[model samples]
Target: MIRGMRGAITIEKDEPQIIWDETVKLVQAIVAENNVQPDDIASIIISTTPDITSAFPARSVRMLEGWEYVPVMCMHEMNVADALPLCVRVMIHVETTLSQRDITHVYLNDAVKLRPDLITKNV
Candidate 1:
């Protein structure tokens, strides 16, 4: 079955290196928590808040040792007036046996605020 795993992370600044680092960290954490392999991933959709324009987060994932062929896309998150800033969010669609409720979602740093209720039970 195809399941979508969600994760997000907040960065202190919009520097390219920092975006790459945090994006990689967030993706890795989510993949590990859900026991997902590169081959299981069908696609990755990544989005950054409007304030972050330094780099494409998908580059970091594509550069992973075994992720060269993983389909990935990058874009800016919906620019809501009061939404969190400098945050990167990802949705990873993967082939998994786990049910939706069994899949763990990862939220790091300030991004944890995005899903407080879910985090308490799922993170």
Candidate 2:
């Protein structure tokens, strides 16, 4: 079955290095939590808030070992009046045996406010 894992993270600043670091951290957590390899990922779609224009989050994912082969796209999030800032969100589609409910969705840092129910404190 094709399953998707969702994750979001908030960065401290709009700097390229910070965005890169946070993106790497978020993707790594999503991959580990889902127990899926990069090859298992069919595609990954990443979006950043309007304020985050310093870098494309997908670039960080491509930097990961073995992730270069994965198809990934980056986009800008729709601007909302009260939306979170410096937030990067990703949806990774993968071929997996896990059900939708069983998939772990991660929200880190200030982005945790975006999904209170799915946020895992320990992660």
Would you estimate the TM-scores of all the predictions? Answer: 0.96, 0.97
Model 1 per-residue lDDT tens digits across residues 1-123:
999999999999999999999999999999999899999999999999999998999999999999999999999988999898999999999999999989899999998899986685544
Q: Provide the RMSD of all predictions against the true structure, rounded to 1 decimal.
A: 1.3, 0.8
Give the clashing pairs for model 1. none
Off by over 4 Å in 2: none
Each model's lDDT: 0.93, 0.92
The most accurate candidate by TM-score is 2
Stretches > 4 Å off in candidate 1: 121-123
Clashes of 2: 0
lDDT of 2: 0.92
Q: For candidate 2, lDDT tens digit of each residue in 1-123?
A: 998899999999999999999999999999899899988999999999999987888898898889999999999999999999899999999999999888999899999899999875658
